[model samples]
Target: MRLKDPMKRLNAGLLIIAFVLSLFAGRLVQLQGIDSGKYEALAMDQRLRRIELPAVRGTITDASGRPLALTQEARGVFADPSLIDPAKRTEVAARLSSMLGLDVQKVLEAISTPDSRYVVLAHSVTPEKGRLVLSLGYRGIGVVPESRRSYPSDAVAANVVGFVNQAGDGGAGLEYAQNKLLKGVPGWQRVEISAGDGQHIPMGEGQTQEPVPGQGLRLHLDQDIQWEAQTALADAVKEFKAESGTVVVMTPDGRVLAMASVPTFDPNEYAKADSSELQNRVVQEAFEPGSTGKVITAGALLEEGLVTPESTFDVPDHLWKYDKKFKDSHEHETYKNITFGGILAKSSNVGTIMASENLPDDKLYNYLTAFGFGAETGVGLPGETRGLLHPPSTWSGTDRYPISFGQTVSVNSLQMASVYATIANGGVRVTPTLVAGTLDEDGAFTAAPAPASRRVISEATSHQLIRMLEGAVGREGTAPAAQIPGYRVAGKTGTAERYVEKAGGYKGYTASFAGMAPADDPQLVVQVVLQDPKKKYYGGDTAAPVFQKVMSFALKSRKVPPTGTVAPTLKMFAD
Candidate 1:
């Protein structure tokens, strides 16, 4: 009876265990056969969740590879309002406000919002401050790395390089012109985030995707030359008390060495500058070029074989006719019979008119057009204005004579420089260019396509013009200050009365100097325009000196060896 009772108990326990095992097996089969794929997919989704991380914008460099505009890492400081401890909130906010130069009340308000899960404490914090804030290990504070554009060169080529916006949009200069190249594709970072609060998942493996930085851009500008040109021009503007000024230096082959306009602004701080200061006046504004136009007229005459360097014009000190009467800049005691060289040397308006009177209007128009006038220079600079050159049909009565001497025609300073550059480069008219190359994300430079060029005139004509320009920079010429001690200097002086919008007449004068140095074998061609110098109104006195100083630096910086000695003093080569 006892043995039977024990067997019955053992059987009862085995039955209970068998029933439980059967229940567990049935549940496992249902989950594995029916819901297993869905649960696995959910786990994978959590593991593979991805978010886009914005890429950093590219750097802009000079031809020599000096950074003009660049980007660096910055930290974004944020706070979770709910997690901020009530007792420690005030202390935390106070410390953050002091460190960040923010108001404590602002910080408190940012953290006080009950509905807001996160608030920006600071948009961009220094690395030192970011590290300090992170070390606090507070429950609410968080730091995220962000990209910020920096101008390490600090406005050396601000107008040319431009700057970027908050959302990484290029604003002006190369930044605006080559935005597609500078802005790279944003990559992705797969971060394991908490399901409850979207915090960094602390206990699990996180994923990261390397950010793709933007492509770098190379400009045609030379940094040393740019610095020299900018400094000298700014100094000249300040010294002359002029309203504004521009300096452009270019190689004979049409490479823009430097272009600077003042009063200038820093690209890094462009937001604070006035709108007017941001405009690149050299390309955007067109003023009547005054006597600089004489170079075009002189070149046209020489190119057509109508006038030679020795060709003489019976020019008076003064010529009076229509509503406007013209005269040479300076009065001489003698009624001098001057040569073509003398006409250009003195920038004589009357002499230029006499030389151009016999030429047909069609030839004149064609000549100006060939020299890259009345049309865009194709420099690709933003806001470039095609200077105002009235065709034969557009010219009014008496416009021809005035236009011949660089009056009644408007042009940009850059256009004037291009004309000189073309003449310097042996009549080969190459398009002026600023960008040297564009780079990819991996720092490989895709060279900028070669600029288009055309032969505007014969080499013989360019040579003849150079000889004539040599006389112009001689002691007897108007631009004596343009003389370089060791090399041939050939250039022109321009003094034009500015057109007054209010009075409907010409008022103040714009003084300018355009020239090419080492005339025997041309290298650098520089053009400077000073608008409304208060004390000095003549180009020779005000603008030519600046050209000398700038070109001197430009020649040495380019390492252009000095040629045969400059003629004892700059004097007309009476050959």
Candidate 2:
């Protein structure tokens, strides 16, 4: 090898240094001047990643703090499609399918998508399954922890509390109506990005923002009382062979303690049931109230000072005029002149019409409106109906006559309950409430206030009406089965012929019983209705027994003290 001179070596070193400097300068210019925006964006993309954190939904509790609906932590499985190898897609999908019960082919297709970076394998998988999947040490598999809405009471207040969909949105009942209050805000997180396959890398910014959970709801439903009502209503439906049935129990102050409908559906399995079964019939379905509406008619008449409890009427069996023959549900070969109280106790249509004949159509309509008829209660529920009560001006001659006996008009079970509640609470009509309060994410209570009441009848008139109703449950009156052993229950029984849309006439019947217990100091009002009972269709036989079972349990559960030692006056008809 030829030895180079020292000058040549020094020159070569300088040139090498120049070359290195130029290369470095070119790189600096490319980063800072030519593509500065791209470099800045790459730096930010490495330092941050937007991630959505769902808010926790609140609990739904009954009056006694029993949870009817609640939330539980669940994990959602997802796959990093870009990181998953095309060859192993089938294998990975098969493993996940076996574990999560997902379709293997579908999952494989999802993970093998060319442009997609992520795919959700399953949602709401149990903790055990999630842990098993996590232990697999798969590079592309990931999990996002989430909260799922659950019904602890299951079918128990299904229609009232309602349910949430997969997207965690409210669908019906209080859930849909109060969505704004129930659904809380969501939050987000950020993370670093790495080189090559765009993988997440930790950069010390720690979970960027903590998620805020959803608010809770407190309902006026008493779980025990609700159970009582449901049991009774279900039994009535089966025993009477009814198409459907509804029962409503509320406090004298208008808080709905319990509302049950037979042929009810479970919220968890709501998708499997018919739309009709999901409805709250107490507020939805309307029926001709029959003799039970005598209470309202009596209220109107007494409030206007048109009749007294002791007033006598020489009522005949057949009112031939108006093409309407008024007859008692029970036959009387030899009718006797009875007192106003007797007429009501026997539920005579002639007596009721005679009493209502003097009141103007305007007065009747006004009273009905005051009692919350032909109007929605404005409860926070989905599809609340304003029942059909035709304007009094539309009343025909026969229509007027039949309306006096609750034939032409239609009212819901809830409205019927409120009518008795109004009488029980000294003629003050209060709006019914389902939810008691809402609890914010911070555990602060935002309670709903009790509805205001309007007086529709005098205290004296209310008391007089109670006395007359007392006679209806006494000896020589109908609804003898409604008599409880220890408590003094006063109520009315109704058997209305259901109108047939196809036939354009009345064919079937709806048996109903509406009353307030203990008559002296009313604590609760309950209504029971059975539609289209087979074999026996009388309200006294078909519906009254169901009321007895529920009322007995309700009195015991609420610890309502008995008013007197006197037993319910038993009545019997001659064989």
Candidate 3:
């Protein structure tokens, strides 16, 4: 009986062994054939890592090819939180915090996040610092290629060049206006990694998509001129105890050589700048333009044959209109007959209104529009105000009278400068431009389209207006201080009652001077505006000196030889 039981047990054991072997063979077949693709995909998903390849940003250069704003090579530090040990996270965070200048609690929170697979520790890390971070050999830590924006000229042209944000996006100025052209496409790379340590596997399968670099911008801004203008504007703003100031220097054909705004910020440290300091006030803010706008009235009168440089008007100390009494800057006895050129030279508000009384309202408004008022100059800058100009239809009962004498109408600095630029360029108004052209990745420059131009008045009328403006810089003129030594200077002074929004009314003066050098043969136009200056609010007293300083520098820098011709004498009061 015992021998028979032993044989039965042996047979049962053999049967069980055969069934277990069959199960193992079937499982092997499923793994190797039926479900092989699914398993292999899961394994690859766990081992493969993707690294971003950041594209190089473009450079912004000045007219002389000097770098103003540029991008430098940098690094982005990251971590795989899932691969870091939970117990070692605190120690890792402490080490990283000390090396990277990060708060330990922030680092710990980042590394200990629940269900987080990846996290960024820092961006824009220097290459040396990045290499030091890598040398720590901490598991789950990695460094990727990135970029950082740099402003070499700093605040020199910061208001014009603008700045980029932490995300590498253009935040303001030309940067925001031309972001798409300045920011290029980014690429990536896929590589196999060691699952045990979260490190790149040497000689592992890898693929790459190379990045395309961004195109660069070449501006018409001359760095040297920009520096000089900025320095001068800053000094004037401080000296005058003014709220703010702006200076724009351009060629007769509308090529902006330098555009500077006081209280500007450095693009490198833009985050700390006040919002007001970031604005490009030259094109963004508008004012009444004061006597500087008299050139338009003079142009209108001359074009209609209503007056000439020698024409005479009855001079009065004050003239009463509908609701306002207009007078010159100073009170004096009425002169019997003041020459038309003398009215502008003396900057007499009553004289300007009296001279333009014969002109039709529509003709005056048409001339204003023709001279580039009430419109954007298309200067290629953002936040440009078209300025306030009530049409003839919208004019109030007394609007026509004030509008004629450069009151009740609004214009930006660039617009007023272009007005003088028109007369300077043979009566043609050229659209102002700051960008000279763009450079491709290969460094080939394609010049920007030529500035648009249209004649606003006859060449003869422009010449007559130029002669009248020259009188404004004469010894008896208001802006005599604007005269540059050895140069035939011509310019106009402006002192308008500035409207203050916080006070909700006009409280202070906007003093300004718009001028051109070598008036006989003009080459450069410089416009200076000081807002709400204290002590001396007259344009002649405050703004003209700034004009002289910047104009002298620009004229000498451009090598514009003086015509050496003496200005013609104009009769101020009739004999």
Candidate 4:
């Protein structure tokens, strides 16, 4: 009986041991099979860190590869509010504020929130500033390398290159128009790091996908010419005490060499610039072209064979149209017989209107439309305005006559400039383009799509109009100031009274000069417009002088050969 009891106790002990082992095995299965993914995810959350890799914006360059807008490498300063010491918070805030130009109170508020693990202190912290902050050994504050958008030349091409916002995206000008191509794809970095310090863990796994850099832009603008145009426009505006001004320089090929607007601002400190200064007035502001519209009328009539250059018209001092009577800029003796070219040289409103009498309103309107009036130039700049061009049905019987002289018709600076450029280009209208092409990081170039082009008038007629325009620049003509010393120049001067909403009539005057140089075989076309001049408001006195300077500089700079000889003599008036 003693032996049996011992054996039974042994068996019971073994059975207890087996049951305990089975329970442990079942627990192991639950942990290793059903809940394995859940614990693994929890460990990954604590161990791995994800850092966003920012993409850079493209560089904007002048035609000569001069940097206008660039993405400069910089460092961004940030703070971990959860890690910041409460007692030393004030001192830390002051240090950051002084070094980074941040507001002290704003930094204090950001550092005081314990729930925030990340708070941005300065967006574009310079490397020097970042080093200074890090040298102070603030435990919670950190610095990371980033890109700071910079304009190297302050206010040089303000309206063209524009300025970027806090997010580093282009907000205006060419930057805004080509935003998609300029901004590159962003990427990410996955790294295993300690949660407490954000330091890479020893023997940790990491993977990084580098961000692709953006393509670079190459513009059609010559930096030197742009500087000249901007300087000239600014000087003219200040000298005349005008409200605003604009100048556009182009070539026969329709390349916009420079487009400048006054009331300008430095794009570098765009935040301080007013909204009005940011607008590119060359393409946005519209005005009645006044007598400048005569070029289109002359060309239209000449192209249709309705009038020859030597055709005669009896020009009276004043013509009554409906209740309104039209008069010249100043009273002049009536010409009993005036050739078409002579009328243009004198800018006779009566002469131009009488010439337009033969052409139907529909034909005149079509010619105006063909000249690119009342439409966008598709220059690809943002905020481009299409000036108003009403249909023929909207015009009264007398409206056509006034429209012939550039009243009751509106056009922007570029449109007006393009009119002369068309004539200079032998009547083929080429779309004006600012962008030359895009350059990739590999130093490869992608040319911008060629601008659309179409013929507006016969080349033979263009030659005849060019001859008349040359007469308009003669000493006896309106724009004697537009004469260049060596080059044979051709252009027109226009002074149009600006309309007032309250008066429903003209108030201020917009003086404008549009012309091309080396008239025999033109290479460049320069346009200048001055608005609300406090001094002299005539196009010949105010705007024509500006054109002279710009065209002179461009002609000399381009090294264009001079015609040397005087223009062909046009009969001032037919006897």
Candidate 5:
């Protein structure tokens, strides 16, 4: 409203303009210098994309390098929820479900996660399907290279090789036991992406770290023998109407050539299998070895000079010891002056108890422990039970007598097999082993360390025991069915009262047989066990035949010829 000088007004306007420009300059300095890292991080967060590159899982191979469990090339379907149109998420999920065979709801839930930048919709998708998914060109949808676990042999060695879960973790068996060594290390990729479309920018700043592939496992298992043993065990289980069955084939030095369990599940479809079938019975399940356990007593007797193979015992039909009446497997007249060898050959409970009478309780327990009972065989398997063995201090008055005959003690099949293996190895107990070595990505093999070993009995005593065990497979012995043609077989039969937890007492019998071939100079040992057989439950009738079939195959496959020496006849009666 007042007339003013033009020059003054112009000067005042210039000063206001200078003040505004200074404020802007100060803000620029703060953003470019003081808060530069913070602002740059926010900007990069919007443009940078970090992707996970999955590591290729290892292969599980037999001793001959036959792949049992392997990993195959696959793809993982993922989504950027922020890039997807909110209104079209349902449609995208429906399309993805059809292409990937995924549940629409699950896919929808994954992609619809609030404020998620990346979401995994499915894993282990076939490459073809992944390409098909890419063909749709749906915004925010992508696929990354991945691996899928496969079992080419189906159910063969399933219990030992184990299966992988959908999340790519080991579910059981050696897979679970050695997962860290097998899974290896994962990697990653970082790249700049377009903010508008989320597509990786060409020639943009990018970095990739290659994944380290998992180390492969080479086992002592022979796939052929594994398949044979599995088939044979399954057949035996079905034929005998037994609840389950297990078999273990090992070298005298404790290399597990074949370990099989019946009712095994296919690792490919492990999701559909019952949890019970996933266990490896050879190492996980434990039961009384019965007369098969008598070898320990025999070792104790001979090692301590308590008795010789010719030591006589008047084995009665029944004997009362600490309020428990022990009887032979079958009705028989009193064995007048039966030799110690005859007691084991016949698998006589009363005779075994009588033979162990002079042996101290602590000494018997020591022999059992030394033979690897009540402890794991160190076979490198997961969930291996030590089995149940009470010390002499914990033994009840009757416990000593029953345990002397293998009644109170419990042992897994692998441990029982090692017993005969130890005896076969001239009394040295070699720790059982399944894995032969580990293989690198380039196929270089690193052999595992040698298994631990210790002397369990004198070499002379072992030879004598082997000779005595040969009588058990002879014509007059209990397990004639275990004999292989042209092979000098030696073994023991076991038929023990099976204790069932649900039944609260002994409900059925566990039939088992453990033997070594060419008894004159043992090379291989095999143990067979059947649980709760319906019809015939004798170890000689049911389990021995399996032992014969499996042992015969193993012997032939290994090219182990017979010793060509006839087994010397041992005295059954001293009189």
Candidate 6:
């Protein structure tokens, strides 16, 4: 089809324009059909944001519902350096520093970084400070809610309660042990942000998830007893001028009423505290138990039919056996012939050795294991030690005599307290527990498992030892200071020469007393240990007084009726 000259020129122009429009149509289809999802995702990424909502930490309380640890509401301030105006950077940094206690130059340096989207300005910021920062109306600054850990009891049970860091992580003690149960599941939200302003869109237009708050912990510790113990221990440590000290108060059932240690630091100021001050010495420090171990030896002898309470032995002031010389705490001409019960009452090393002369070292070692030595108490508290208990194979020829009197054995104060507790529990060893129960997320109180118990001694043998311990607290016994008015108290005194690490010789002394109250029907087992008391290194003089004070206070506070039974006067010697 041939066209006229003018018509052909018009048709060519129209054909060219039509081809260009067709190309544009094909390009649009390819872009929309092939890449629609990718473009949509990129757009959403620019405007929509997902933010994390922090969950509340659990509360820690004593058995009496007294709060020990709590989580207080707080805020965290963050910044988007990319959004910060360079011209007003100094002004913003100075304002933040003044309000949040941050250094101005650091803030300036942080916001000056190029293309930085997020920078944490301050964690654990107070609500007041957060409000002040928000009032400044800076586009780059953002405030998120946070929590600050607090200890209500101060340093009373500081070692147990422990302190959390700024990021809300548990660092030590129960807090660390129960961290999994104490920290809850966090929530999240997906919201759209306005392009002009960095504010989140309304909830109806966004997706939100709620947080699950953590469970609460209820410890078995008694508030009244813990306070009494802390005060008494602190005072004794100071007065004795000892390097350190510890006290463990427990019920006959193995429920820990109080666990206290000296050189404690307030958890509120944990950052400024020395690491050494945070140690829980009751579970951490091991020392030779000294003559207090005679109770074990005496019990073993009676249980194994080697000696009766009335059995008599000609005990010399100096005992030479297995190529080692052992002497009593003091030399006395009249102490030659001592009865089995008299040996414990007087804390006589030579007399105990003579009583245990028939018993083998393996038999003694087995008994010690039954009494809860050589293993951790399994109280579930963090940083607990198993202590040192040598096997019979590790003992030398000279070891049997020394170990029988507690010279060769090492034990922590908690283990020592448990020894008395076993006797008080009528020869049953109960597992010590700190947590009585846990509060559910719904605020329901759920009781934890009852502490496990196993028989460590026969009831008959336990009674025999109890009677023997009563004599030790009598006026004729070693720890006369351990007597409580109107109460038949029974305990053993431990005075061991401390071993020097570098010199490998005897240096200072560790004085300790462990016993239970109302000796006939025991209720509480209390142990007080003073390490290296300069003035008086004798357990009778140093630790017995502390035991009396703490036990007396505990008895009164707990309203335990005193046993009207008079403490028996045990025979010091028998013919």
Name the runs in model 2 displaced over 4 angstroms: 1-25, 32-37, 43-49, 90-98, 101-114, 136-138, 191-207, 324-326, 500-507, 565-575
Model 5 Cα RMSD, Å? 3.1
Q: Per-residue lDDT tens digits of candidate 3, residues 453-570? A: 9999999998888888888999999988998888888899999999877899898999999999888899999999999999789999899999999989988887888898998886
Query: Across residues 533-565, which tens digit of lDDT does each residue of candidate 6 receive?
Result: 897789999999999999999889888998677
Candidate 3 local lDDT, residue 483: 88
Q: Which stretches of candidate 3 lie over 4 Å from their true place?
A: 1-18, 88-108, 200-203
Per-prediction TM-score, please?
Answer: 0.84, 0.88, 0.94, 0.91, 0.92, 0.90
Candidate 1 matches the true fold with a TM-score of 0.84
Which lDDT tens digits does candidate 2 get at residues 1-575?
Answer: 44379888888889999999999999999999999999887777554546667788778899888988878888878777777767777888999999998889898888887876556788767788888987876667777676777887777877787788767788877777777667778787775434344445655343667767778888889998888788888877887788999988887778998889877888876667788788888887888899898887888888888877767777776666556567767666534556777778888888788878898888887888888889887565778777778887787766767777788788888888898998999989888888888888676888887677899888888888888887787766788888988788888889888986668888899998988888888998889999999968988888888878888888888899899855333221211
- Give the runs in model 1 whose Cα sits over 4 Å from its true position: 1-52, 78-124, 133-141, 190-199, 202-211, 331-335, 500-505, 565-575
- Give the C-alpha miss distance for residue 425 in model 3, angstroms: 0.6
- Candidate 5, 1-575: lDDT as tens digits: 55399888888889999999999999999999899999998888877778877778889999999999999999988888888898999999999998777889999998889878878888889899989988888888887778899999999999999988888889999889988889899899987766666666778877899999999999999999898899899999999999999999999999999999988999988988998899999999989888899899989999999899999988888989867788987999999999999998988989888888889889999999999988888988899999999889887788888888888789999999999999999999999999999999998999999999999999999999999999999999999999898999999999999998788989899999999988988989999999999989999999999999999999889899887888899789986
Q: Give candidate 2's TM-score.
A: 0.88
Top-TM-score candidate index: 3
Clashing pairs in 3: none
lDDT of 1 at 91: 91
- The prediction achieving the highest lDDT against the true structure is 5
Per-model RMSD to reference = 5.5, 4.0, 2.3, 4.1, 3.1, 3.6
- Ranking, lDDT, top scorer first: 5, 3, 4, 6, 1, 2
Q: Which ten-residue region of model 3 has the weakest summed lDDT?
A: 193-202
